[model samples]
Target: MIVSRGTVAFMFEGSQSEVLTEFLVSARSLSEYRAMFALSPRDLAGRDILDCPGGAASFTAEANRVGARAVAVDPIYATSPNVLAEQALVETERAVAWAHHHAERYRWDFYGTLDAQARVRRAAATRFAADVRVAPERYYFGALPSLPFADNSFDLALSSHLLFSYADRLDATFHVKALLELSRVARQVRAYPLLDYLGNPLDELVDRVRKELSTNGITTSLVRVDYEFHHGAHTMLVADRSN
Candidate 1:
């Protein structure tokens, strides 16, 4: 079975019988990022962007192709390009299988069908694999709460499917610290799907983190975006550093 982003080990209230223990590295395209973050053309033109926990996403490759200087940061990037490329394909398959099994948990409007979604992800993984081999510098080996960039190094930082999506494993403190770290490197930060992998909302955690960010001089707002694969997950958390 394929495991897609946010399809990791977690039991919903009364759905999904199997438990997945590992974090599934999934691939997402640039178009998906645009919709998920409400990113405009201006957001991409001549901007420096950072994608943390980038997984196998083609966002960095595609964004750079269109004038943006985008870099992807993930511990998996430490793996050899050939090995990571192969692993991405295998994980993409697992993600697809997981998504297909829990089809009802997701809204198919954006993808139209499971097959289409699979194709899009597979293509993204392919692009990421090829790009990593050619432009390895664009992919950095780093994790949240501590990145290797200078302060305000990026115009925007995009974090997807890792914060609220893994709330079961990552605590409120981690979220606050990670968001602060992202804000440290970029003027603005956006994280999508303020819900757990089970499609369950983490309202309290979100609220707590937002309040903490406010206390720390980071302004946060909940913004609805055009993307919703996980049902009821139409919002992205936006954090802006105080200028």
Candidate 2:
């Protein structure tokens, strides 16, 4: 579709705007996961990885195809796959509508145009939906600072979008509790896109959590990552248990 500077003027030849919107529901691929978490294949190999708030992404599914032992935890996993798929479609439409209304706020560099953006998203969602049909056990339904797993259960813990992205909805205490649970489960905990949905840096909250974590003997660092799907989302927060 034609994503112009000021208006959506016309559709491209065989533009898959509707199709793209359907597939681009929500999910970051495995490459994105590796980039955000600063992980190589060797890092994930034979490691028990935890993906918190993993949406319709193929990270766990694809990682398992190689050698990593990965699992996803998200509230949507509690619902039936069919129901989740339907909800994803609705969310995709809503997101597209929001983008259309406020086009200026977003930098469409990563996604060239709106139609391609939808297409890519739809593909990720499709992969996730197929994987769920084969093995739903890889997914667990839960929220955090209160996960169901035992302490020190995972080798690596990764979280995205939910915590810092919704800073307005969740406060500093919530972040602390979430980080505590994440740190409790794994030796290495990494979270990315440490910015609000409206593109605000969460330095104050990050600083608070960092100081509190230091007090508890956990080391925290702000790491620059290679991924920048969102503006100002160039860094990730890494927390490791101190010996």
Candidate 3:
């Protein structure tokens, strides 16, 4: 599979096709989040954290288990746990298939094989399903550019695969607003993969967003991380409210 700037491309046998659509909601694990954000033990211990557009990921569930007070906010959380679990599994399968199809576009070192990637995602989705059912309060209904939280509500915020990954659909203004909002609720905010879903670099967009953030009393920087499932996606944007 290969995707153009605004559409996903799929090639079967000899024919190639493009589909204009939204990126699949991903189910990343706590381990994956740790690497993607370069999270340290201190980062997850006794700290209040927010995961925006959390999708089907088990980060919130796992983070809380390890001592962090983590909460996930996504519009999809409005649905019942059973329904969201089913949707999570379906989206997980789609994401796995897409990743396998575009095998060449990713780095296999992190997952070893496409099968390993699928297994991790499935497990994460299952954990997310069970956790959301038991601890529904940990998950909230919200979206980007806005959130239902008071100022400095969290010690840190983690956002993944929603901002730059869908730059094709989310514009510069939206990115600026979203970053500012995240900064509003957390003392520190970290967003991973400074590229679109197709592995395309978004240097211009990142720079623009950083400039906008700085003007709003938010300081931003690009930090290299240890994870790189998407080739060249080893950097994360870290934003902090200026003291």
**lDDT for each residue of candidate 1 in 1-243, tens digit (9 for 90 to 100):** 111233233322334545446666879999999999999999999999999889999999999999999999987777888877887787788877778888989999898988999999999999998999899999988878889899999999999988898887789899999999999999999999899878988999999999999999999999999999998999999999888
Q: Report the Cα RMSD per candidate.
A: 3.9, 8.3, 4.4
Writing each residue's lDDT as its tens digit, candidate 3 over 1-243 gives 111121122322333313326556789999999999999999999999999878889999999999999999987887898888887887777778778777888998888878888999999999998899899999988877789899999999999998898888789999898889899999999999898878999999999999989889988888999999888999999999987
lDDT of 3: 0.86
Poorly placed runs, candidate 1 (over 4 Å):
1-18
Best by lDDT: 1
Residue-level lDDT for 43 in candidate 1? 98
Q: Model 2 misses residue 224 by how many Å?
A: 0.4
Give the alpha carbon lDDT tens digit for every residue of 87-164 in model 2.
555554555565555466566676688777666666666677778877888888877778879989999988877778
Off by over 4 Å in 2: 1-25, 96-103
Cα lDDT listed for each candidate: 0.87, 0.74, 0.86
The model with the greater lDDT, 2 or 3, is 3
Shift of residue 50 alpha carbon in model 3, Å = 0.4
The residue pairs found clashing in candidate 1 are 2-93, 2-94, 2-95, 2-97, 3-94, 3-95, 4-95, 9-20
